[model samples]
Structures are given as structure tokens and as C-alpha cells.
Target: MIDDAGSTLTAELSAYHPLWHLKRINWLEGFGASVPEDEPITTRVFLIDTGVHVGHPYLSKAIDAQLAIDFSALPFGLRYVDGINKPIEFDPEILDHLPLSANDKATISQLMQRASGKLCKAPLETALHTAFPSHGTACAGLIGARMPGFFTDPLPSLTDGKPALAVPYWGVDPLSTIIPVSTSLNPTPGQLILALVYALQNQADVIHLPRGISVAWMSDNGEYDNPGLSLKTDQDEAEWEALEALLFAISRTVPIVCAAGNSGENSLAYPANLSLEDKGENGIISVGALSSAGFRSSYSNYGPGLTVVAPSDDATVFNRYQIRINELGRRYRLHDYAGYVGAGLPRVDFSREAILSTDIPGQNGYTGYSPLGYDEDDDTFAHANDPLQGAFTLFGGTSAASSIVAGVVALMTRRAKMKGQILSGPQLKQILRATARGTPADTKADDINGDKASLELLFGSGLVDAGKAVGKIGA
Candidate 1:
């Protein structure tokens, strides 16, 4: 249950995401079967969201700075532009998302042949709409935080050079390169289509869209409701129709992971709900947020289309490091709430609980910068006294969960490369469904909207099993 009293439950002196907080990282080693591979092929994950700060050491160290692009700028037609407004190095081998004429390929080849390394701007700066990397950077870090071997392989930890529990675990695959494309927080349907088109042409292995467009709807009382998803009436068919075609085209190329919104209802959000029917199954994978206690998050939306769940708040029974899934799994230890702790119904404290990640520099939310949000202190709730408050902050939503799954997708691809396995988009979804861990059976089904069948309303297939998904490639 969320505490309306506005009390702080968990705080600390540093800014980090402990492995305990992100229990999914531990699944890289096959959940209890095999250990992490010695060396895996590096893959690329395309982040389609708020722009990221490419200079951040944490993300920069793990990614190729050359692959970053910003789409929230002028000339939205061609593709996601660089900070200086130049075209990305087009290689036919990696880029097959868009069908290009032979002449087009020849022209690109000529440009690359005459390319100069110093094409960057004199004074580096991205457009206002695209420069802020707050949300996108955070998601990129979770997928591949530039730490030591710790990020690539999860295990025991030592905080500040001392043995400490709840060690801030980093990315699922630190070696994966990130292609940062700045799609706005609230982009028009036109802008959304362009971003999708770019992802396909650019050779993105796994694409993560952490935001959704909620169309207004009318309630039973004849009153228009707030911005929520209305399948039939929300945003005209013409608007979403063009984008859905692009979505179908892209889904066939790469796995697109989208968030299931944070509205705390049983509604379906667009883009997140964009699925291509193949073999009588939906191709889009929607991710919901999970609490640290291994239960469905109270603020997470639940309904018919959820594909899997991941952690958002790090204060539940699932986050405890030493605890294994044995006979002792019956009793769970919750961090903030001590009330009635049961199996899957782990209660979460929204205020004091969150996933720490990279924040926009000098924004109103973080100290060193001016206000970015309407209120300068919008992010103070997450980063109160951290020495590097301006660089890192905390956030908890389906956005974070979506990125977590995207990171695992990178790991899955890496495992596939080593084992000479080639699994398509549909195959990956089946592996996730077969291997995922089920959520608490106590929560009631989401029958809010009529005529919707649900295996588990709160969580679709179940909690994402990172290790099992990767292991399936070799099997």
C-alpha cells in the first residue's frame, strides 16, 4: 500500500543501484544452472526516449560515443541527427531496417569514403528538445553501466570498500553499446513514426520505448476523463495507423520493449500495446513494474497485454541477496513495510522507494543546474543529500522496468552470438513465457474492462527470468 503520510522510508549517503535492488542482474548466470560466459559478443540496444548526456562517464565508458543520435531537432525527416546535425555513418551491413535503392547505397558509400573525422560542431550543443538526456541516460546505464566486471556479472559486493549488504548492482550487460536517439517525452504521432523508422534502418538489436501516448476517453457518467487510453476513440485511427505500420515493420527486425504506464489502472496505452499478430500471438512485449519484495507494484497498470515484470522500487523481499528460492522462500522480508508480509503481495512505499539513475545536469530536480521541470525541486524527493545529486537521481515507473528488460535482451543476444543460435522476435517471446517466474497468486484479476481474458492480470507471463531467457539460446 502507498503511504499518503509522505514519510521517507529508505535513504543513504551515496548514489548507486545495488545488485540487491536489481535482483534481475543475478539471473545472468542461468538462475542456478550455468555461470556467466567468459566472453560474449557485444550488441547494440537502441534507446528511443528523452535524449542522453553522452559525456556521462558511467554510460560513456560502456558505449561507443559514435553511435549516439538526437531526433528531437530540425529536419526530422532524414533520421536521428548527431549533436552537430550531421548524418550517421551509414553502413549497409548493419543498417537494413529501411529498404534503400542501390543508388542510395552507392551515394552513402561515396559520402563515407570522403568522410572527415572532425565533422563535429565548434561549440557542442544539441537542440533544446533533444539535448536533455535525463531519462534516456538512466535507462542506458541500467542496460550497460560502465562499471568493472561487476556490471557484466552479478555477485557479492562491497560498498565503499567495505562489506555491505544491498550493494548497488549495475547493468545486466556492461559491454553492450547504446545508440541514444532523442525522441521527446511527449512526441506527436508524426515524430513517433520517424523514430520507429530510424530504429529499423539503423540496425538496432533491441529497442526500448519507455513512454506512451494516452488518449482521452468518456466515462459511463458521460464525463470526459483525463488523459487515459481509449482503444476505440483515443487519438484518431489516421494518427496511430501510420505509426502502427512502422511498428509492425520494426517488430519484425528487433524486439521492441515498451512500458505498461504508471496510471495504476487496467488500461492499455498506445505503442506499448502495438502488437503484430503472427502465428496467433501478439508480438509486442509490454513490461510492468515490480516491487523489491517480488510482488506486483501497486502503481503499475495491469490488464490483458502485459508480457513480463521487473523491479522498480528496491525495498521488497525479492531484493534480499542471501535469500534463495528454497524451502525458506515461504517467509519474505520486506524493507519499508512490516505489516502483513506474505508471498507475492509485497507492499511498497512509493515515497522512499525508487530506482536510482542518471539525472539531467543542473536541472531544477538536481542541484548544480537550473530548473528543468515546472518546479526546480521536482527531483528532490529522490536525490536529497547525495554529493553528486546533479548527476544521478532516483525514478520508479514502467519506464525503468522496460529498460531493465532491454538490458537483458542485450545479454540474450550476446549469449546467442557465442552459442551460434539465431532466435527471432517471436521465438524470444516464447522463451520468456516458458521461463518467467510467476508473481504472487494472491492479487485479484483485473476485470475492470469488460470482455478481457487474463491468465494473470497484474503480471502477464510472469517476472522476467534473465538467465533462463539467455540459456534457451544454447539449449
Candidate 2:
């Protein structure tokens, strides 16, 4: 079932793309059913994560570069001022300009100091080496990537065995504007709060936090365990309380969608877990990942706070060489690989599925440029060049799932705006929950609790159905 390299058995490349998920959520049908209009209302979804590549072909049309902000430059920690050491503070003029309470400002200053200490001990830049540099680009593409116009000829399907030409990679709400807010690779609570405030100020219709924060303590077994919401320090409490207040305020006007986390634990990460608290009509919408099989993904965190599930990758193995060759043959028409023989081709394990979205262009990001020497069998080195190889990649996790939900929310916002109505965050959540479909039969039912309660714990309301949500909003 698995090879020594951990690569899964190979299957057709179509199985790893997002079209299957798109169809399952009824994306096309829902938008197709909407009333025809000369001009559809444009909505904005603020994405706070690693910076996006604004120049990517699929994302260039949707990104609003003028409104984008790089918050990674925010200073944190102590600094000597006039030979006197003091906590680094925001300029008095700038502090006065903000609409925050005095207490919140003080807490922010304290957080900045704490974040600085953490950075000093272990810089986040080192961690970025193994991390996805194009994380923000991937998330943004899921929300608003427009279809590229390069493919004049029909390409092989990227979803299933259907004979019809596969649709090119596109996002749920291609017309929606993306407000990119760049933060540190691992953002601290203060940075996240500041980003939220910025998004609010910019009039973002929906906010997508495709990352999570966790507060953990070392156990007796010398392992760290998360203590959700039960913060140990006064500073931690103050920061979370402030964040909760801001989220509540924002939710009154626009929906905030957050990832449930990638750790396969029974409890959710912080902020996302905050959704469990009773916020009475308005709260953060926590999203979990669903495998192509319609079951909870093995790596997706679960809990009562989870608001809904969305399709994502669920493979245990990845054969990079095979994936690249398949893409080149199918999409780029570079099919002269001597290494790719009939039945001898490598197989991927666990039915290897992934979400196909935009990536950072060039060899810097995932799906690196050209797969020429990666495989040993290909002697035809001269014919192995693919110019657009790095433009797209297969990405997954609750991050991708949350982006899908955010895009759906954007579509709903546009639909409501077209009908001359403004739906509150709570109203949008209500519509999504009411219209969600049930979990698949293959979903694990081992929870001691009854089926309905257990399903809610694992999948929140259920799988997010875009068509139903949009139709409800329009009605």
C-alpha cells in the first residue's frame, strides 16, 4: 500500500484537483441558477496569511494591490530610546488615531514585547525553509483565482474519468476582490488582532483566517497539550478577550471564517475553538476538512466549535515525479517522456487526492519548475521543459477548506447585495448551517454520542453546500 519513499500508489492526475469538490458543493449549479445581470456586484474577502504573489496569472485579476498591506514589518520588543530602555510602543499620534480602548492598547504593547522574546529565542524565518512559501497564494487562489486564458485547446479532465474536457483551474468567486494582508510566517495574537482591525477599517465584506493559534502546556509525560480557552496567564486572558471582542464586533457586519487546524486532535486550536463560546447570533465560523470520500480528513482537527466541512486532500503519500509528468502530458502537451511507460508507471497510495490551486510562480514554490531530472527513466532531457509548471500546485488542509467556505460566503454576499439586502454575519451563518448537507455514510460513527450529535461534533452542521446557501440568501 505504501512505498519506502512514502509515495502513494499512482492514479490519474484528475483525482487530485478541485473540480470534484466543486461539483459536490454544487458550485456551478448554484451560480447558474442565479438571476442574470448585466453586472454582478463585487464583494471583498480579506485574506490574512503569508504574502501572496500578486503577479500570478490566475490571481492577478482578483487581487486589489492598492489596498494590500504588509504587516510583517511591525516592530515588536524593547528598544532603547535616548539611552533609556523602554517597551517598544506605537507612536502616540498613531495610538490616538485608532478607535481602541486604553486597556486594549496597553495589552497590545505587552504582547509586542512577548512576541519579541519568542522571536529572539527562535526566529520564524528558519521555520519557513520547510514551510510553504506560497501559502497565501494558494489560499487566495481558492477564493478568487480567475481562469487563465492560455488554454485554447481542450485539456484532459482533472477530476474524474469523464470524457468531457476538464475545466481549467478557477476559484468559486472569481469576481470577488481579495484584500491581501501579509503577516509573519507564524503570526502572534497581536499581529492577528491588528490585521483584523485593518480589514475592518478597509470595509472587507468577509475575513478569511487560514491559520490558527494554540496555547499549550507541557504534560507530565513531557509532551505539550493544548488547553483551549483556559489560558494560564493574565496577559493571555487579556489578549484573547480583546480578540474575542473584536471578532464579535466584526461578525456583526461581516463573516469571519477560520481553519479548524491540521493537527488531528479532538480539540480545536485557539480562536477557532473560541467559536464554541456562546456569542449569541454572531461568532467565528470554524471550518474542517473533508476527504474526497466525504469523510473527515485524517489530519483535520475536530470539535463542537467546527462550523462546517469542505473538500480537501487526504493522501498519505505523494509521488512528485509522477504528478509532474502527468501534468505536463495532460495540460502542457509535453508527452514525449521516455520514462512514462504503460503499466510500469508508479502508483500513488491512499487514492492520493489534493486541491489544485494557484502557486507562487517559478521554482521558489511548490510544483517546482520542470520535472526533467527528477525521474531516472526519462532520457529525453531535451523535451522536458515546462514553462508554466510552477504556476499551479496541489494544496490541501483545513486552510484550503476555509478558503472555499470564504469564497462561498463572498458569493452569498454578492447575491444579497444584488437583491438590495445586507446580511449580517449571524444571518449568513444561519443560512449556511440550515442548508448544509449531511455527512456521507462512510464517515466514522464510533462516537459514544448519538449520530446527530456526533456528526455535529465532526462536521459542524454538515458539508457546506454553496448552491443551497446562495439560493437561501437570494430568496
Task: Identify the candidate with maximal lDDT.
Answer: 2
Deviation in Å, model 2, residue 167 alpha carbon? 8.4
lDDT per residue (tens digit) for residues 50-162 in model 2: 66777676777788866665555433211111232233233333334444577876775555444321111112342222234478888998998876652224433344555
In model 2, pairs of residues that clash are 8-348, 8-349, 9-347, 9-348, 9-349, 10-347, 10-348, 14-158
Error of 2 at 241 (Å): 3.2
Clashes of each: 15, 8
- Tell me the lDDT of candidate 1: 0.56
lDDT of 1 by residue, 1-475 (tens): 1121112111221223345444443443532222234653667788877566666556666655565554444333113334555654434453244344454434334434443222222213442223345667678777777643343223323434532222233566666778776644555554555555556666677888887764332236544333223335434334445455556555655788888987767754666765425323434678888766555565577777678887785322223211122122122222322332354442233223467666554563222344322222222243343344355656667888888888777777777667777666666667777777774532223322232436466777788888678777788
Q: What's the CA error at residue 460 for candidate 2, in Å?
A: 1.2
What candidate 1 gets wrong by more than 4 Å, as runs, is 1-17, 28-40, 74-84, 87-131, 148-157, 160-169, 214-239, 276-282, 314-352, 362-389, 439-455
Total clashes in model 1, counting residue pairs 3 or more apart in sequence or in different chains:
15
